[model samples]
Target: MRIAELGRRTGVPVPTIKYYLREGLLPPGERTSPNQARYGEEHVRRLRLVRAMVDVGGLSIAAVGEVFAALADQDQEERGLVRALSTVEVAVTPVPEHEDAEAAAQARAFLERQGWRSDEDEPALRALVGVLGTAREVGHDRFWELLDGYARLCGPLAEADLDYATDGPGGWLEREEALERVVVGTVLGDAALAAVRRLARKQAARRRFGNPRADCGTEGSAEGGSEGPAADGATAERP
Candidate 1:
C-alpha cells in the first residue's frame, strides 16, 4: 500500500504519518520510486501503536521514541518481555522530585511487609514515595492506614492484567505483538482501573451511607452521613 492508503487504513493523516516518519516513531516505508514508497501491514500496526501511545498513554514524542528504542533492544529470539516492559515503564513514568526520606523508607517498608521485592529505583516505588510524602506534607497521615488493603487488592488486579494481556482478543500473539498488547494494557489499564474504582466507590457509598430518603434512581446523597475521609479512602477513599 502507498502512504495515502496506509493513512486511510490507519485513520492517521498522511502528513502526520510523515511527521512520525521524520521523528523516527514510524519506520520508513519501502522506497518504490523517487517520490513514492510502499507500506505493508507492519507499518499499519506500528502506526496504530504510535497513535495509542500518543492518544491513550499520553506520551510525548521523545518518550514514544524511547519506548520504541526499548522495544528494539529486546532480543528477537529471547524476547525479554520483563526488561522491555521495565524500560518502557521507566520511559513513560515521570521521575518524582526527591521528597521526604521517611516517606521513602515507609514505602519500601510497605513493600517489604507485602513480600514484594523491587529495586529502590523502581518508578512505581518512587511514585508511591512521592505520594506518601505529599500526603504527609498535607496532613493526611491517616492515608497510610489503607496502604495494606491497596496492596492486597492490587495483587489480583496484576494477575488479571497478565491474563488479559496474554489472552487478548485474537488469542495468543507473537512475542512482539504480545509486548505491544502489554504496553497498551499497562498504559490504558491504569485509567480504566481508576475510573472503575470511582464508580465502585459511588455504589458502595450509596449502599453504606447514602441518604435513605433520596430517590434510588438519582445520585447518592450522603446528607445524613459524616464527612468522608480524604485521599481516596472509603471510610477515607474506597480503594
Candidate 2:
C-alpha cells in the first residue's frame, strides 16, 4: 500500500503519518520511487498503535519515544517486558521531588507490611512518600488508615492486569504485538480504572448520604422550577 492508502486505512492524515515517520514513531516504508514509498500491514499496525498511545493513552510524543526506546532495548531472546512497562509507568507518572524523610519512612514501613519488594529508586514508592507528606501537610494524616485497605484492593487489580496483558487472543502473539498490547492496556487501563473508581465513589456517596439531588428536584418542581437562593448559591458554589 501507498502512504495515502495507509493513512486512509488508519484514519490518520498523510501529513500526520509523515510526521510520525520523521519522529521515528513509524518505520520508513520501502522506497518504490524517488517520492513514493510502499507501506505494508506492519506500518498500518504501528500507525494504529501510535495513534492509540497519543490520542487515548494521553502520552506525549517524547514519552512515547522513550517507551519505544525502552522496549527496543530488550533482548530478543529474553524480552524484559517488566522493565519496559516500568519505563512506560515512569513516563506517565510525574517525578517526585523534595524528599520527606518521615513520609519516606512511613512509605517504606507500609511497603514492608505489604511485603512489596520495591526498589529505593522506584517512581511509585517516591510518589507514595510524596502523597503521605502532602496528606500530613493538609492535616489528613488519618488517610494513612486506609493504606492497607487500598493495598489489598490493588493486589487483585494487579493480578487481573497481568492476566489481561499476558493472555492474548488465541493465546499467541508476536513480540511487537504483545508489547503493543501491554502499552495500550497499561496506559488506557489506568484511565479506565480511575473512571470506574469515581463512578463507584459516586454510588457509595449516594447510598450513604441519600441523594441530595432527589430532594432538590422535588423542591424545584414544587416551586415552579424556580430554585431558591440557597439552591442557587449551592449550584454556584460547585466546581
Candidate 3:
C-alpha cells in the first residue's frame, strides 16, 4: 500500500505516518524505486498499533517506545502481550466489551431499580469488567475493587472532559485535547479525590469535635485500627 492508503486505513495523516516511520514507531516501507516505497500489512499493523498507543492510550512518545520495545522483547510472557493488546483494544474500541456491557447493563438496571439515576457508562464499565476479568484470572479481586472505586469517578470526570472537549477550535486539536483529558484527568482526579477526602475528614472533625485531633481518642478508634491522636497513656484506664 501507498502512504496515503496507509494513512486512510489507520486514520492517521500521511505526514504523521512518515513521522512515525522516522520515529521508529513504524518500520520503513520496502523501496520499489529511488522515490517510491510500498508499505505492506506489517506496516499497516504497526501503524495501527502506534496510533492506538499515542491517540487512544495517550501514552507519551517515549512511553510508547518503551512499550513497543517491551512488546518486541522475547523475554516477555504471553500474558504481557495479552495485557498490552487488551489495553490497546480498550483504547482503540469506541465501545466497551460485551461482557462489560452486560455487567454495566445489569448494574444500571440495579441502580434504576434502586431509584438512582445513573447515566449509562457502557464503555467505562465494560473496560472495568475487562480489567477485572484479567485481574481475576490473576487471582487479584481486591485490586478490582480498588479500580472500581476509581471508575466510580468517571461519570463526573467525563463531564468535565466533555466541557473541555467541546470547547475551543473543534477539530483534531479539540479531539486531541479531549483524549488527553480522559487520560491525564484520570490520574489527576484520583490523586485529587484522595487529597479532598483527607482534607474533608479533617474539616469534618473540626466541625464535629472542634479539634484537629478529634480521632486521637475516639470511642470507636480510627478506621482500620489506625492509632487515634491520643497517646496510649494520655487517657485514664477505663473499667
Candidate 4:
C-alpha cells in the first residue's frame, strides 16, 4: 500500500505519518520509484504500535524510539527486554535531585523489607519517595501507612500478571511481542484496573451497608436512617 493508503488504514493523517517516517519512528516503506513507496502489513502493525505508545502510553517520541530500539535488539534476553521496557515507561520524567533524602531512604527500606529486587537509585524508587514526601507535607502521612496493605494486594496481582505473560500455552511470549505487551499493558492496564476497582468498591459498599446509596455520604444522615434514592436510583447506578 502507498503512504496515503497506510494513513487511511491506520487512521493517522498523511503528514503525521510522514513526520513519523522523518523522525525515525516508522521505518521507510519500500521505494518503488524515486518519490513513491509501498508499505507492507508490517508497516501497518508498527504504525499501530507507534500510535499506542504516543497516544495511549503517553511516551515521548524519543522514549518511544528507545523502546523500539530495545525491542528490536536481537541480543536482549527476555529479562533484559522487560527491564528496558519498564525503565523507559517509568522514567519519562527525570528524578529531581532535591527530592527528600529521608523519603528516599524510607522508600529503599520499604522495598528491601518487601524483598523486591529494585535498585535504590532507580527512577521508580525516587518517584515513590517523591510521592511519599508530598503525602507527608500534605498531612496525609497515613497514606504511607497503607503501603503494606497495598503491597499485599499488589503481590497477587503481580504474580498473576507474570503468570499470564510467561506461561501461555505455547510458552512465554516472543521477545518483541512481550516487550510491546509490557509497555501497552502497563500504560492501558492502569485505566482498566481503576475502572474495575471502582465497580468492586461499589459492590463492597452495597454489601457492607445493605444499600449503595447509604455509602454515598448524602444518604448517611446524622440520624443514622438511610434516606435517599430508593431502589430505582440504586438500580440505575448499579455497576
TM-score for candidate 1: 0.82
Task: Summarize candidate 3's per-residue lDDT along 1-239 as a digit string, tens digits.
Answer: 88899888878899888877777777678999998799998787667656655665556676656555544542333344334443433443345344544444445544454455533553444555565556656777455335445446655665665454345334323333334343344434445666888989777876787543235545434441344535333433433
lDDT of 4 at 139: 83
**What is the Cα-based lDDT of residue 9 in candidate 2?**
100
C-alpha lDDT score of every prediction, in listed order: 0.79, 0.80, 0.55, 0.73
Q: How far is candidate 2 from the true structure (C-alpha RMSD, Å)?
A: 5.6
Candidate 2, residues 23-108, lDDT tens digits: the string is: 88888899999999999998988888888888888899999988988888876512566777788889877657788888888898
lDDT of 1 by residue, 100-132 (tens): 898888888898899999888889888888889
- Pairs clashing in candidate 4? none
Q: Please, what is the TM-score per model?
A: 0.82, 0.81, 0.35, 0.79
How many collisions per candidate?
A: 6, 0, 3, 0
TM-score of 3: 0.35
Q: In angstroms, how far off is 45's CA in candidate 4?
A: 1.4
Candidate 4 residue lDDT tens string, 128-217: 898888887888876676777778998887766555555553567776666666666665665567789998997786678665334455
On TM-score, who's better, 2 or 3? 2
Top candidate on lDDT is: 2
Two-way lDDT contest, 1 vs 4, winner: 1
